[model samples]
Target: MYSSIYTESKEMYDELKEWRRELHKTPELGLELPQTVSFVKNKLTELGIPFETKVNGNCIVGYLGSGERCLLLRADMDGLPMFEESQLSYASQNGNMHACGHDIHTTALLGAAKLLKKHEQDLKGKIKLLFQPGEETFEGARAVIKEGILENPKVDAAFAVHVASTLPVKTIAYGTLTATSVFGFKITITGKGTHGAMPQNGIDPINVGVTIYQALQELIARECAPSKEVSLTIGQFNSGTMNNVIPETAVLQGTLRTFDSETKQYLITRIKEIVKNISKAFRAESKIEVLTDIPVLCCDEKRNEEIVKALNLMNAELKIISGLHTTGSDDFAVYANEVPASYFMIGAKENSNTIYAHHNPKVCFNEQVLPIAAAVYACTALDWK
Candidate 1:
């Protein structure tokens, strides 16, 4: 049955590629993916797979088969907030790009929907096809959970696969603690505004912001152990509008990523401490607002072994690799928290040249992994007990 799925997906490769390219052209951003959602719903309807919209019509949940034992297969369809630099014929022109290969995730899951529905009667229980939105903003999974994507049939376990543009085609990578937890925050520094020529007139928040940024960087290098994976990055910084006049407020937004809970808490505490004390020292007031707080994604060891064994027996030459870790984070941790779960990365490296990591404007993934991931998704569901 597993080998048969591989053959079926291979035969649908062209359709999968067409779907991927169609999605690649108009990569929607954040939670408000109307067009993308409609496209998916239409496709699901065409496949005769029933679905319902949640998260204010953003999150999509499609179903196949029946029984109390349900397995959820999830895929995110959001695009990054960047313009595409790749000169492909179907490159995104809407100023948003799917540089993270989420387009492939959605397409592969769609392919899986077709495959699973084709073999719906063969499923041991139920299959919940989770078409998640706003994964880039880290809101999709939580939204779906709040709207009860985990309930209804009540999922027993969940599985998701992300495409890795850097890994060679057909390579499947999986392991524990695959993604780091993230604490996204925005810091605002308020100070007195004054003319540029008056040195003693006002406090400069930009100056304070620069100092705080430098200190936060040192917090990672000096405070955290070298063996620990801790990354504190300031992705956005904004201040005054005029060059000559000092602005009243300066804002700094960044994210803290770590694999250790204790370390994450400690660093978060230290970040607040640093922001508070440093701004005060500069005679400025500061405030910290959390934008997103997601837990680390750790796959179940026993579940991982089971899935690996099944996938391997399904396709011996599948090139499955284990013991891999990534600094990048995903909201899939929300699902992993609720049930026994496992995740894997399918390789999509297209060439031997220099590789472009995810979120880059120039990044493009190999489409060959499209059907392979689709088959993997279908096989996982069909074989799950």
Candidate 2:
């Protein structure tokens, strides 16, 4: 039933692999993706798809078909700030890496654009291709939304796919509750600096920071219900610069993840209270600020069911796995919140050896999954009612 889609996607496999590797080699970070944008623009131009570049960020929206009703397929174009350790021939020489598989997502969307263009005459409605930037930091989807990517013809639904290294290649994972929402925070503890030996003369902000960090553990452990999934992780702690000198300030950077909005608010309130009270107890001053907030990703049940049914009718050899969810957060949640959206996970695990998790320095995945993802994107756009 999906033979033509496979053949077209497979025909572009070599090209898709090259695109992914090139993107992987020259990974860009955040919204300012000049090289990456240029590459995608060149590809879009070659495919003859007309696109408009957003003025705010490096967001590119391309158009295909001439119908009225529309569907959108999005692919993130930015890489993480971490260094690459994949050791592939095309490994990034720069510090940045596509550890989150945005490279594959971009390449797959490019291939999908190619496939969809090949069958444009058969498409009943229009398809919008969004190549967005800065999913790692700022919510690029929000930027895309602000720029009105969902307008013009007006998209009826939106869909995107993320690559997972742990799942075997050719497996499609779906979930009702797709991904957890996150709140990233930076807390600073301030106190007077003095000689390291004269502990009694000045307040110790590091000690206060430690106390606040310890108290934060109870936010999820004791405060949140046992059945609820909430995680509080402190990723960075910075304090004294020298061994002997007491630092005047200590900064703690962390993220809070949860599926419940009320729980998210509770965690933030408790964190502020804990930091303030803990610092006051130690004769220190403190400040807590939210750096980023990503809403939980929830799929439209009806749209997801329809997409699953469409996938089942396809002839692709991939395994279709449903009812899957992840603790990780995605800025795509921004779009899912705004419109009827369905986000799926594509398995890219190549071997049974060592599966590296996403955002890891040595993260890697099977390139063969690229065509499958592209096909799914193209078919979803082509077959959706």
Candidate 3:
């Protein structure tokens, strides 16, 4: 099982963990990952692996084996824009940090690439190593797709692994479908500026903003079904600078998340109606715009079952979770739309009490999961077809 694979390549696995720690120390954000890109490219070069860099500026793609059946393995190369708080010796140098465990992801994929290269002659098909950037902002996967990563090799099936804090270490959580869809909206209300002391001189956008916010709550409560998972949160708001002066314009930004397409559309339409009606009531003009849209992630059940069987054969503890309709979203859905895709969770928590959630400054992953994850990546790819 997995132990044989680990014992056969113990040295390589240890090296991968070291690389992961190093990456954790020097983290980069978004598509601007020069150091990380160079590190990956140099390692590939030393191993005599062929790769293409900067497909979308910092996104790297490496190919191994030459068989007809091809599989794609992806890892996010970007870090979050947060300060480090961990006391590890290899703490982040700059303000940025690997709070989301992208470092571990990159290292695991690299390890898989190396091991797969050693067994290239035995491989039944080609393997595409995808080192993506800007996953924190959900832009990297789309950027890689735009660069033709899937077109050149033509991915038949794809797999991506993410380390989880909630799951126990060395355990695997496989979901048939992942609930992650995020939609952003910006609302601007225009009104006349006037002094607070004025009794009835001009329309106040602050009052209109408050009314709109309250109405938004009512819209969700009355319109959306409680059974359907949905969330709408206003994350940012801006208005007047002084207490006495009423600002002429007020801006509000928020995000909407849902697993149902019809519910998503209904929420968007209702949002527009609420903004319009609330503005009209206060004699103000309002405009609403959708900044971004991420579709819900749906997995191919057959492919997922295949992956689960493979991992179980590897002696990895398995758990089948009833897919949840969640508020968080991922761009991985974009790739799933085109092909059979499986997104698996690798446990990184040392224990229940010590685990920290993603995007938190104090978040850190158990590095030991790197080798297990790497092995899973290779085994899953080999299991395909």
Candidate 4:
């Protein structure tokens, strides 16, 4: 039965495709995933996979096998807070969309749960299924870790797969330094409220915010080395309401990402110093709030070799590409930092030139990669030493 993992996963294609489309329709966001959790719970129950809700109710943990060595297979179950423009019949009408292909991630893990459960007795070790919530906000994994989501069984290794819309279908890419660390922040600038016409009476916080934003951007180009992989992006800026009244405060939110820890620390210190000194020069009060701090997703090289070999042995026809890395961040970084772990990207793009990247409203993934991902998840676990 274990030898037929790839074939069986392919046989379940229609069922897995339905699961992905249904999940794509009713996407949830943040730590609160009510309907999404309910659907996962029901499916897990039907498959006779026992699981317990932990942390935020929907961040569930399902069990398989009972040996000393355990492998954690994680799937994030949250979506982005954006409207879908993809005119597919099952496109999400709700304000939220699974533009990141997390729907495919969750469904592939479920398909793995089904396959692993069918051959539980032949397994040499344990496989822990983590149906995590709040990945987009970077809160779910931290909360779960606090409550000991990794303690009860103490996993030896972990694995995760993300769907990529730009790569050809059925291609699997692996690498050592898979993703960059991220530090998300919000800066608040406070200025006195006054009539807009009386510009002399009030300090302009918007001006201070604009200056700080510019300084932050320049840090990457001027302060950092050209060879270092670093980036800064300010996504949101909110200030005044009325045209005649000067607002009391302005807020700017942004994220900084890099692969080097020393570089990350240097930038954070510079950011704080820049904000403090810039606000003082502008005669405005300011405060900086830390929103998220995640480490770089550094895949274990030896483990990567083992998993890559296991995957090829599982399906000889499967394409295994190497040396792919990105600056984008994932909270799976938290898990990889804790244990010997590896991550893979399975290609999910349709055969078309217009491939929209992740988080795009019009993004679509090839459903054919669903079973391939499921097979990879299950076979990787079953074949692990």
Name the weakest run of 10 consecutive residues (lDDT summed) in model 1. Answer: 306-315
Select the stronger candidate by TM-score from 1 and 3. 1
- Candidate 1 TM-score versus the reference: 0.99
Q: What is candidate 3's lDDT per residue for 1-385, written digit by digit as tens?
A: 4445554445576698789988888899877998999999988898789988755459888988886778888888888888899777889979999988889999998888877777677677888898988877777777788878788778998889888765677777656558657788999999998888993888888888888888887877888889887888997889999988888999998888888889889889889988998899889999998877878888788988887777677664544353533455667788888889888877788643776788888877887788888888877766766
| lDDT for each residue of candidate 1 in 1-385, tens digit (9 for 90 to 100) | 8888888999999999999999999999899999899989999999998899998898899999988799999999999878899888999999999999999999999999999988999999999999999889998898899888888889999999999988998799999888999899999999999998894799999999999999999999899998898999999999988879988999999999989999999999999999999999999999999999999998988878887887886788889888878889999998998898899999999785768989888888999999899998998898888
Provide TM-scores for the models: 0.99, 0.97, 0.91, 0.98
What's the lDDT of the predicted structure labeled candidate 1?
Answer: 0.92
For model 3, what is the C-alpha lDDT against the true structure? 0.81
Local accuracy by lDDT, each model: 0.92, 0.88, 0.81, 0.91
Query: Over the stretch 49-120, how does candidate 4's per-residue lDDT look in tens digits?
Result: 999998659788999998898899999999999999988899999999999999999999999999999878
Ranking by TM-score: 1, 4, 2, 3
Candidate with better lDDT, 1 vs 2: 1
What are the RMSDs of all candidates, in order? 0.9, 1.3, 2.4, 1.1
Model 4 TM-score, all chains together? 0.98
- C-alpha-based local distance difference test score of model 2: 0.88
Q: Which stretches of candidate 4 lie over 4 Å from their true place?
A: 1-3
Query: Backbone clashes per model, in order?
Result: 0, 0, 1, 0
lDDT of 2 at 320: 86
Q: What's the distance in Å from true for residue 200, model 2?
A: 1.5
Which candidate wins on lDDT? Answer: 1
